[model samples]
Target: MYDFQKTQLEFIEHIKDPDNKPFKHPVESRRMDIYRDLFFNNIKGFLSSGFPVLESLYNEEQWNSLARQFFATHDCRSPYFTDISKEFVEYLSNEYELQAHDPIFMKELAHYEWMELAVSIRKQTQKWDASKTVSNVQMSQLASVVSYQFPVHQISQDYQPTEPSEAIYLVIHRDSDDKVDFTLITAMTAHLLLTIENNEQLSIDSLNTMMIESLPQLDAEQVIQGIKQIVEQMIAQEILVPYSISE
Candidate 1:
């Protein structure tokens, strides 16, 4: 019985790291190679899909080294395929380190790429009225309001930032067409979206009123007009979906 668990763990560890694996099972090396390739390829696919931009930034050899290290060292516990990307992010945070030539913002870039897929698959947690007017609104789960130290939205092969600059804010979401959209916004706009997101207990109208009251220095009518335009735009872009009770 003890040998059963020991062999199981040995097989798993060896499959994850075939090159320097300590355990030599009684099985033939050919069969073991098949097992190793199958499992590693499955994980590699998820890693690539979750961080496409990061993968593209590296040449094949560099990318393979990183992926191999993660596959061997990271103990992923998620049972869902979709959760693999989440595990990849956690692995990056805890277990992975950048090479000498790797970008300083590699982890942040990977995280930014993973977020789009995360938002795409997120289930809407609340029922919203599709027919309701945009004057009052609630943000959908599809939208993710995030702030970064660097402009992650503009990152590419050419636009790497060497130093942290001003705070960069963005709202990312999947539209009705199932296309992911990134909207660069001001800090103030990010706050407005966040307010709608966190204050689930209150309706949008009540929340807006509360927010405007808190900012007493601003003209009340002007603030309302600004918020109105933002909400309307979000609805038009399908970033925010409206809903109503069947009354």
Candidate 2:
């Protein structure tokens, strides 16, 4: 007896690469071509939407060739359609073959694009009822404060750097308005956020003391006041959530 399940599996393998595999399906060739095109095109469309800039950088033929290779070789784990972008990144990071014409910052750029989507989708779990409901956590847990060697945020077709320069510091967070926003931060600001991450129970006074200790040559009072203002701005920007409202 002919096994339907085995035949279906064989049919799928052939569908992924119609030219290479012999089509064992008794179904007409025209109908099988539809299945092959439909399956691959949908995946390509999903990827194209996620990495629009990456797509733009390549010519149509080159893009289609890369898409075909990815479709044939990559085994995507994400069942959710929205997470296809994440899977694409995983593929690029692990298995993408670098071409001579491809930008050296391709991986960094892909990650930057993915980071924006990831931040937008991430939700805040802290419960706050106008100063009553208890929730305290580190900034690292609630936000993405990152530093990259490449100036990824500045990359475009018009401006592609061949070599690395100064570090790029960024804070990406979802605001009270439920929209994702990106801001450039100084190295000092990056240090402050990292310190808060390492010391989860940091208060304004403690942060000021640490700042003063680090920059001993500077006047303590001026440093403390400046640190306070920076922290206030961080709070206002929703980059850092304060444990105590008054603090």
Candidate 3:
């Protein structure tokens, strides 16, 4: 390899893991120290802001140690700072082994927090049509339906759960006002949203048929009524938006 490329690799290694990878290139120690601190601090700050609840559960020393480990270990795919939270969520989900002090809900909570950031920043291509009927609909681009074994939305320093609760479902969405919020939803609502998301477009009658097929024990008329109410509520929240088959 060329000398410049080798030096660049060494520089990055030292920045990521200053404790072990010595900066072998003849750079001054003070300058190398500044680079290392600046890079690590940027990552740490993003993580703290992205997962405030997760950060709150840890002491300063523990949080820094966790952030440092992620910095040294994870290979982030995106180059943008806004993407760091997503990378951190991926790291927690796939790479990092849970330490004793790490909360069991760490992965779920991190993902929940990341979803809020993601929904807030997502670009919406389709304009909302208030005049469209609720018969035809699609899941909003700015919304997501997620389920977790723990109540990640309720997790905090004072309310940490040691044992997993019943599976909880949530619909996190960015509204027309560009405000991000989450609504705790029943499993049926989550299922309906996911079905709409996967299918691209569905009508209230079609959804009722699907639900009736899945749940034969329920009366057909009652199922239809329930689905209509659900669709109307979702449309009101802008979680489900009108879509024509042609579009």
lDDT of each: 0.80, 0.77, 0.88
lDDT score for residue 103 of model 3: 91
User: What TM-score number comes out for model 2?
Assistant: 0.82
Model 2, position 188: C-alpha lDDT score: 83
Put down candidate 1 lDDT per residue, 152-230, tens digits, no spaces.
Answer: 8788887889898799888889876678888998877888888877765446678569779877999988788888888
Candidate 3 lDDT over residue span 1-247, tens digit each: 6987988888888899989888876788888778999999999999998999999999999999999999998999999999999999999988899999999998999999999999999998875555656567888899999999999988887899988988899999989899999989998888878887887567767887888998789899988888888888888888988866566
CA error at residue 67 for candidate 1, angstroms? 1.1
Report the alpha-carbon TM-score of model 1 versus the true structure.
0.90
lDDT of 2 by residue, 1-247 (tens): 3687878767877877666777765788788779899998998898787788778788899888888888777888878888878988888899997898788888877887888888878767754324543233247334688777778888877778888778889887778777777789998888878887788666667777788888889899988778777766876777777564343
Model 2 error, position 55 (Å): 1.6
Clashes of each: 4, 0, 0
Q: Where is model 2 poorest over a 10-residue stretch in terms of lDDT? A: 128-137
lDDT of 3: 0.88
| CA error at residue 113 for candidate 3, angstroms | 0.4
Ranking by TM-score: 3, 1, 2
